[model samples]
Target chain A: MVSVAFKKNLKEKYGIEFNNEDLLERAFTHSSYANEHHGKHNYEKLEFLGDAVLELAISDYLYRNYPKLNEGQLTRMRSNIVRTEGFSEFAKEVGFQNEIYLGNGEEKSGARNRKTLLEDVFEAFNGALFLDQGMSAVQRFLKQTVYPLIDEGDFDASRDYKTELQEKLQINGAIDIKYEVIAEDESVPTFTVQLLVNNQKVATGTGRNKKAAEQQAAAKALKK
Target chain B: MVSVAFKKNLKEKYGIEFNNEDLLERAFTHSSYANEHHGKHNYEKLEFLGDAVLELAISDYLYRNYPKLNEGQLTRMRSNIVRTEGFSEFAKEVGFQNEIYLGNGEEKSGARNRKTLLEDVFEAFNGALFLDQGMSAVQRFLKQTVYPLIDEGDFDASRDYKTELQEKLQINGAIDIKYEVIAEDESVPTFTVQLLVNNQKVATGTGRNKKAAEQQAAAKALKK
Candidate 1:
């Protein structure tokens, strides 16, 4: 059973209050725990629901807020936000390591601090919140947590523009993709790269290195 | 541009009326068309949004309607609904092939009826509807189109229970998966199969043939 004090603590710390405390409890209850305690609900079903809920929330936010971002960029940004490590970090910040219930065996095996478990719990928590209070409440809660991280550009560093460009161009059928270094400034040590799709010059960029220049050109092509 | 008569026809045929005609037009405008016509917007961004919108709607429907279904079943069911062929069927029913805008070359190449394009158009239409109204509006549209098909078991035939069970059990780590014919009744022309996950007899089934019995056993294990 989840304590009244724990519920109060959630409200105090995270601005979240659940009317049905059982869902909140279920959100933190791992399948291992449920297997050990017969007939108890686990977080798996809730995690499934939460995954979709989070997708829509993130998609809507990115679509509206990032008008300049293309579909590929928006997709990449959403993936970064919802990835295992990112959600695990959110769970850690919420102290789920202390709150989560697991089987004695699983707990002994360090499941409490496991990244995948923490990520599942975070999603399950959001799923519970959505069921209890609806989408707007979940959005508000995200505003307090994930939205700030998004605003801080926490999800931007992992984009591989070159790969994205290749995928987009190849979606219809296989086509020739080339990134050619056109010129180099010896004094400044800068390389200029041109991106060609089927030998048609699409975009150009200059950077301190060849890879960076190629990536920059690909990024430009994606924007085009 | 989307004509007033086309809008009226949509309202009469499918109970859909768009407040923003421009968004409706954009939803049907292919990238090829947009590229051919300078400054014209395409359905790519809207298709991205619509894809997430559809995912959440199908997920919510499955989660609420299938109380006995586990997360694995729910995911598989959702995939069947949102797959290219399924969405393309919906697009065909909506007469999108006639309404869609394409470039000269694309139209000449018969892209208007292309399965993937139709699926993208179906998603883009829903996305535009979501932006024009809200999630409720999109839900209402699906009630008229996709939801009935789901209720009719249109998405049920493609289930591979064996693959699903394997995926679920293997998510934690790889384990030995075996299906053995435990018994055979030649006179009755039936076989009994037992599914063993890591040497544990999890579930059993009987069917007219070995393959059928194995699938049934796998399905039973998944339900467990």
Candidate 2:
């Protein structure tokens, strides 16, 4: 059951007051809970609508905000943010962990803490908001939350590859990795970088800049 | 260059008049054309934004109009419509093929008829419309075009599997294909169907109804 305190907190924190409180409740209700509760509506439909809304909002934000970035770059950045892991992080930040209603079995299994469930609830929340308000209100909610994160370069895909590779490779122990400029073409201003893991050639990447080439190399290496 | 007649036609046909004609022109301008013409902007960015807009619009339409459908069914139907082949058909219907500006090379290669290009142009056009007017206008346009097609069950995923399977298996000549009820559980009200091709069982599926079971069986057979 949704608490009055939770409703008050939403109204105060985000200036959101739901006319249809049931919709809000539906957003937080897991399928497991619905199954146990005799065909009560779950968050799945809301999640579906919310997913689309998020995609469009993010795409619009990236398109309007990042003027210099090409479509491909903007696309990569949007993809980085509009994913399960990314949404889970946002859900966590919004304190959704405690808000979600789970079945006794799911609660026993600690399903509330699961990233996929968190992601779904996040989307479901947005969908409910969209239904109650509209796209502008949803955009306002995102402005308070997601837009700032984007401004902080939290979901920058360009910087992500190299950082992800380093984090992943370093998890085992301290490991030596090098990205060396193997070739430079002044005509096209292209730089080719060779990536080495423990002094062994792993991947080579070519791009318009050194950072881009290194990121590409890291991306290729990660695939391996 | 975008023709005045094109603008007039849009106004006459769809009652759509762009405040920024350049944006409309940009939507129709191909990247290849932009490269040849000294980087004078292209449709890629618009296409990216348009893709999202279309997704959300379709999602909203499906959610509101098809209340009985589960999230999974709605998702599958959306996927069927929001694909390259599907968009290309819509683009052709909207007469986008002639409106697109391609490079000399692309034009010589007969790229105007290419499904990929048509799809891109379709997205670009929607994106441009979104930028010019907004979601409501795009919804109106889709109501005039796409919504009708959807009403006709043109992209129905449930019926699609059986039809697609039959079409694929019967490309050369008429082939004997049959759907047999293998099992029925009255307690659970479950129907199990076996898909047979050339008098040999290819796949089996279970569902709530015989039609659903047949579709599932066909889907499995198609996978094989």
Candidate 3:
């Protein structure tokens, strides 16, 4: 049986209440508990659903808010926001640690603090929310929990060299740039990219990999 | 310069008009063309961005539509919908072959029907749409093009043993099932799963891999 106090606390924290107690229970029930019980309940499937839901919510939010942001920027931002650390923090903020049901071994080990566990729990919660309240409610929950993080722009900007190169090329009237992995070795594989102007190869670069080579090639071509 | 007749034809067929003619042109211009042009224009980066956008869009639509679908189901469905064959079909339906601007060599080699080219062009188109009209337009276009195929259940049903096992377990009130990859070898790895009831291993199975073994174990447990 779910504690009324726990439900009430969750509602106060997330600004939502669960209509289906089973869904909430499923969210908190760790795989270890299901293992010990011989698999009567677990959060694995829910975790999977929650992952997709979280990605969609974050992607949708990013897409709408940053119209000028390219796809690469949006992808990196989504990855940063949905990473284990971010989800764990979100789980703790929403009071999942206190409310979760864990097996004896897991409880003793402080599995609640594990990044993977917390992230899974966070996803499971989203799955539960979707089951209990519906997609709209889950979207609302996601917007509340994740939208603020996106607005903060805490994602790493250095990770988007590809987007940067594309934008730079577009601005320079060199609209065509290609990255191809022509060779791979044990070390850094060589990537070859040829920059074109009116269907002519103006610049070619070789690097440790396709991305690096492309960036170097683009940078070189830009100078011309 | 974009052909006026082609632009009108695209609008009539796709129900979308190009806001930025350059974006559309860029979408159609392949890396080979850009490489031949000396890197003045290319669709490779756009293809990359479009791939992500397409994935997110399809994932979002599936999440919203399938309330009862667990994460695995949604993932399998998404994969089925976005696989090479599906993309090629979508490309054909959209008349992409007619619109895409290919290099002379690629054109002669029938790159238009090539799965790789089709997938890339589809992704590039997605990138172009996202750039031209933002997320809403991309989302709408994806929903119209992809969602219906999913709704019609245009995927192999046999690929979802995990889901079937879960449903059976749920129905039978045998909630405890656990899968573990016990051993791996050069040829076929062995997996072990125990189906428990009140902390007892009621049934156990072995298979080529953990997932297959778990499913078999679940199947055996369900029979009891």
Candidate 4:
């Protein structure tokens, strides 16, 4: 049974309570718990739904707000915000660690405090929120938590390779560096990125997709 | 400009029409074309948005319909539906190839009919629909095309390992196989799968995550 304290906390924090409390319960149910119980279902499906919901919210937010940022920038931003560390932090902030349902063995392993479980609860809650109310509710929940993080520029830590590389190279004095897509292979559709410093190519990196290629190139350049 | 016949075709097919013809036009506008035009913008942003919109729609649909399928299965199903080949096929069916705007140089190079361009158009169009209408409109648009494809079970091709392996083994007559997780190393968080045939361990495979481990093990077993 979900606690009155948890429900009260939700009302205080997210400013909405669920009409179907069972959905809320299921959102916190770990797979191990469901496997042990005869009829209980886990949060895996909800996590799947939540993952998609979170993706939509973050993508939409990035799309509308950061008009000047390219797709790669937006993608990197979303990744920073929704990654396991970020999600786990959000879960902890919202008191999800205590609310998570676990099996006897899992609980003995201190599953409630596990980062993966916490991260998952954050997503499952998103799925539950989307189901309970709609897209608008999910948006509202994100606005309160995620939007603030964006405002603080907390998610900017990753994919700042250019800055890091520049800073590193600046110790040796002014440096000129550029990244160019050296190849775009059609079969796998990967982009091979080459980093050039002082008009000479120094490092090369390849990503199967667009976003990672530039970062990978920069990261390799920094290492050199 | 988006053609009147194209608009009529969309109306006949999707039963929906866009109020913002500009968005529709932008969806077909390629980067090379925009670079030459001096004033026109490309469809990259729209494609990014569309990718998210498409992800959300597909994920929600899978979550609702595939009640018994786990997260990995849902992920594979989504990947098959939205991958380059699938998106290109969808774009061709909707006549997006002919509609694509390209620079003189690009057109001469046959960029307009390229599979990557076709795939981009499919995503950009989705983004346009979402921006012009909303989430509901995007869902409606996908329901007309992608929903039917899912219903047809066309995505069953990717994870048919059981069928394939069984077929291969049946020729040899009566095979007993058991897959066990011998080790789960957290540094990579990989599941090491050991495949036992007739109670004798035949092969082992490792994957960075859960979904691919069993399949990798199966594939290795078959190779043996």
TM-score of chain B of each: 0.69, 0.73, 0.66, 0.71
| Residue-level lDDT tens digits of model 4 in A68-140 | 7987788788777777366775676677888888889999988888878888889999999899999899989
Clashing pairs in 2: none
lDDT for model 1: 0.83
Docking class of 4: medium
Candidate 2 per-residue lDDT over residues B31-59, each given as its tens digit:
88899998589999999999999999999
Question: Each model's DockQ?
Answer: 0.56, 0.71, 0.12, 0.50
In model 4, what is the error at residue A17, expressed in angstroms? 1.2
Worst 10 residues of 1 chain B by lDDT: B151-160
DockQ of 4: 0.50
Off by over 4 Å in 2: A161-224, B161-224
Candidate 4: regions farther than 4 A off: A157-224, B157-224
lDDT of 4 by residue, B72-153 (tens): 8888888777772667756766778878889999999988778788888999999999999998998887787668767756
Q: Which prediction has the highest TM-score against the true structure?
A: 2
* Structural similarity to truth (TM-score) of each candidate: 0.70, 0.75, 0.52, 0.73
CAPRI-style docking class of model 1 based on DockQ? medium
- For residue B119, model 1's alpha carbon misses the true position, in angstroms, by 0.5
Ranking by DockQ: 2, 1, 4, 3
Candidate RMSDs in order: 13.6, 12.2, 17.9, 14.8
What value does DockQ give for candidate 2? Answer: 0.71
Count the clashes in each prediction. 0, 0, 27, 0
Say which candidate scores most in lDDT. Answer: 2
